[model samples]
Target: MQGSASSDFDSIPEVALSRIWQEGWLAPELRTTSGERVSVIYRGVWTHAHGPDFRDALVDIGGRIVSGAVELHRRSSDWRKHGHDADPAYDAVALHLVLCDDAHPPLRHRDGRPIPTVELVGFLSAPLDDLVARTGFVELGAIGHGACLPTLAGERELDVRAALREKGWERLFAKQLRFQQELSAFPPAEVLYRGFLDMLGLSANRQGMARLSELLPVTTVERTAADGGSKAVTALLLGCAGFLPLSPGEQALAGLTPAESAEVDQRWDVLRQHWRLRPLPSYSWTLDRVRPANHPVRRLAGFAGLVSGCAPDGLLARFSELLGEAPAAWETWLSSANPPFGSARKRQIQTNLFAPFAYAYAEVQGQHGLVDWVAALWEQLPGAVDDSVAKRTLRQIVGERRFPIRRALDEQGLHQIHHQGCAQLRCFECPIAELAMRYEQPVLYHVDEGIRQLQEEIGHEASHRLREG
Candidate 1:
């Protein structure tokens, strides 16, 4: 490794170069050969493996900031020798760091996004001692997931919130159109029941739930509501889902109380004979990676209670009337407690099921005011409660910063962006990425200090979790 002297520029080892970044000399005030100053943040989580030398680093060129993997080389053209331009794994690279400056400022990944190149020619400096610190945390791995600080930093939180709200409203209407398509084949009542039951699957098993709804049919449940109440409908759903216990003592139904387990067994026995229909076999129910609360049986019970209480008119009508009032109006609306759908899950149902269908109903009837009111109600509901998706994506973008999601609409927007933008790398269509592209200075990260502060504030639990995620 060469010393970080001016004469030693060409011979600087890649590791010594990394020390210069870790020390923050290459972070600010470095200019491209075209005389445009560059700013960088989160020199990126260092990688000892192949592919990009740095993953998820943020870089600012002129006024725009971008985030992605970063490749380091002894010379600008080494990337060509390495053939990274043809590699899909390097497609997300935000910046390319090289020791020697070259004419090629625009590098294209195999996927076609142009990568920004910044040579540390005028930025490197002599270290006070032999470069000994391992630069950034090599062992801790990626602290956060995406480099979104630069993207989100360019705008006011209000603007981001507004964009998120708009996206959410847009999604609401999109759902309306999708629900309307269902309206063409089935009655509105059947469509409403289908919407409610499908969400029981909670993304993973939604198709499975929808299939079960078809097998039992909401019409058949309505027929039994008078004689058997919710218990009969629950029996029908659970039996059809193949989730009914073969025995009261079955381990699969272990969480249920003895009485409740007996009820499931008793109900299934009577319903099995009454319908003379064979269950889909337990194999039909998807339990893989499923949480207990969202298990198909519990969700079926939850829907059964709603269905049993459903007005003689229809579920759509009930939901429409409920949506017209404040969220608190339905406080005691649901009565299933085996696995209680708490306040968060209740709000989740409102956002995912109630709001969209309410808006759809309003549109079909030309109730513009109801449409606006439902949108307003949607705005007030809290953002998604689970930390699963937003936390992961937001951490990747913002790094150790607090998760930026606030409104339920915002969480939906994040999901939309993640699905539509980040996954497809459609930065041009993404507001966040578009904002990042205009940033004068990408969020510059002081890796050593940031780590110290993050650890000091939340301690090792967060860091350990951050790495684990």
Candidate 2:
């Protein structure tokens, strides 16, 4: 893939390009491929989410100060290749940056608005190779190493742990408040169902998934399931989602066996007439690069399974009962789910959907006892530390050093810090920054001692795991 003149630019990697962008290594005055003058007021937050590489960036394009998302690629063609052309999330993209302007007809958003494209080669501050050499290979979308890391590195490890835990509690409270706000607008069950649907889509197809939830709400799904069964629920969802293939051949093309296809279509045939919700266009989904298991089809199937399994109990009541039960039981149930969602996805649903919703539901019902239970459950829940943002922020906060992310609280704290401080470029007001400032100078002895203690702690954990295994 790396050869020829354009291929040379291809070899530079998107991460390198992002680093250059973050470093502000572009020429003083930049111009798009169409010769429009472009000015960089703010590069935006490097949020590696579903849509743009950078969010809420400020740019001056031909004297107009435009505020929107910014997307970067090695080649302009990658914009379409990555399905951004169809994704509604990219509609807000104000600017597109690329090394090669290979895309014919220029770039346009999903809404057909023209996106200003900047080819970096002509706008570089130095030779491409030299600029790449200077920029190195920073992680794509990672915020820079925390300015507070050095001062915090020298403090007691206990202090650092306590700080993260405090931030974690703050994050939990924020989630609770957000859920409560939604509860005010909608019933608890519907709100929770909506949240589950949103979380199931992960980053890529979240918008489409949320839209699906709104169209086929909890009340509708429950009634449909009660009347027909899980098949009815699955059929209703897939039909609305635009995934129920029209014919046997299309079903085959979509990897559905004849029997499997027939069973769903049979139910869909009956349901479609009664529930005439407008189907989402296929383009609304980002289906190309997603793993098979995490495919929207399987996620919808899993959701249908949840509805049928819960039955007359309803989602909120069943999940609240699960919350009171052992955490292992919940994990086991999720693991053994009909579609079998992975631990990571399961943890995501638990952390983002169930826990916050449970807290909100309990508070609205004035179940004072359950409120305290949910708070305790949040503390003990394992964090989804594998999340890219969590991993990136961990490195930003701790540098090359290793720190155990033991609880969901720890992960949530990292997320809170990232959204509020690092991503916003407001390090001066960060809690870690304030903590670092409390100690005027680095304590060499404490830094060394902390490192030693961390090593011993990690070794002990490994040994304990080995014994258990």
Candidate 3:
């Protein structure tokens, strides 16, 4: 039943929309007894529709263009509510999109033919729902933290590593594309600077990072014309970010060097100019719970140092080269000390990882690397289990369920078999046996041949002890 007048179909969450499709709530126009189409977009595969400009579109299914969407919506009546019926703009609507078939009397195509409606619910099954329910959460923090623990067994490591690498690369490229897109209009150097700041800001503290990013550009513009001076650059960056209000301790250190002290004075004036031109917190950047290493200021300073030291074009290539090395090498590069600066100034630069590989990856790789890293970490450090028995039991239970276990588990489970007891002689409920034999045995009979032999030997030893007594 529909709720009060305020219930609007457009308000549905994207997750719910996807679920509706999964659940077969929307009927596809091209459905057979076999199955339904995965999705229906207005523009089909050939059409080059840009974001927010949903004019003529082609729809796709399984990577092929199935049809063209002249019109799309959460419900059929949306066509009329949005006044598409009267507007000539919607005359090309080829498919009607809806979450449910709740449209009145159905709708027709512009050619006096009946437009096929796609309801999303028909494909979703109960098992799929269970799987989704297990994974989806309104709050990310609420997701079970222990879900990744199965990857820790020796058998699972390679599987886990492979998954991490694949996903990580995806995140990296996606982020790189986005950075390129954002910087399409700016000069290469400015583009790189903006991207570096954005990577530093990231999703953790959006407002603070944005504020710093906007100011950095303005400062850069001023510094370029101000004779390419380091003093000017330093002053502009520090002052624009509102960090010019040096603490008394910082002031005392600055006073120790007359040249540095004068630069600080010039920086203070730039800071004043920055405040006058831009509204306070123009970027709306926030610093809530941000670590010193992750701070936007540290990242900006680091970027400033990098730009001051190296050519912009070479930075990304150098970063990629560094990342191609072993993880230990990367750690060393990141932890190395700054080239040289005043004691007080050196402290600021040293806060960020020296190599800036992570930040570079963030700018270039983006979510792909982040997600892959998280996945890899998950595999390396899986959570606790009751025992080998419990591990084997879980492997069997999961196997019997016939669900898609992640790739990490497939490798880890196989690896366990080479090292642990076999299924015949181990405990039924034990995970070790299940893992050793590839999840064939149930909880009741998870033993190995070695374990059976040991049991016989133990029985003889017990009988001898009894006879002696």
> Which predicted model would earn the best lDDT?
2
- Model 1 CA deviation exceeding 4 Å by range: 1-146, 150-155, 246-266, 311-314, 335-338, 444-469
lDDT, candidate 1, 1-469, per-residue tens: 1345444544444554555665575435777656777777667886645577778887777898877887776676666656666667878777777766553555567766655667665565444234423342122222123465534644455665665666666676787788767777887778878887776677678878777777776677776665677677777777787866635433243345667667867877887788776777666667787876766766777676677676354465566566646566554564343345656667667677777777776777788998888778877867763757666555545556555565778777766766665664444355654444344134434444555678889996565444332
Name the candidate, 1 or 3, with the larger TM-score value.
1
Q: After superposing candidate 2, which stretches have Cα over 4 Å from the reference?
A: 1-147, 150-155, 246-257, 440-469
Note the residue pairs that clash in candidate 2: none
What lDDT, from 0 to 1, does candidate 3 have? 0.42
- So what's the TM-score on candidate 1? 0.62
Please give the lDDT score at residue 235 for candidate 2: 83
lDDT per residue as tens, model 3, 358-427: 4333445454665455344334322232235435544543333323433333333433431332332122
lDDT (C-alpha, whole model) for all candidates? 0.64, 0.76, 0.42
Q: What ranking of all candidate models by lDDT puts the best one first?
A: 2, 1, 3
Q: Which whole-number lDDT from 0 to 100 does residue 187 have in model 2?
A: 85
Model 3 bad stretches (over 4 Å):
1-152, 183-185, 202-204, 218-228, 249-262, 268-299, 311-469
Task: State each candidate's clash count.
Answer: 10, 0, 59
Q: What are the root-mean-square deviations of the candidates from the true structure over C-alphas? A: 13.4, 15.4, 19.1
lDDT of 3 at 372: 57
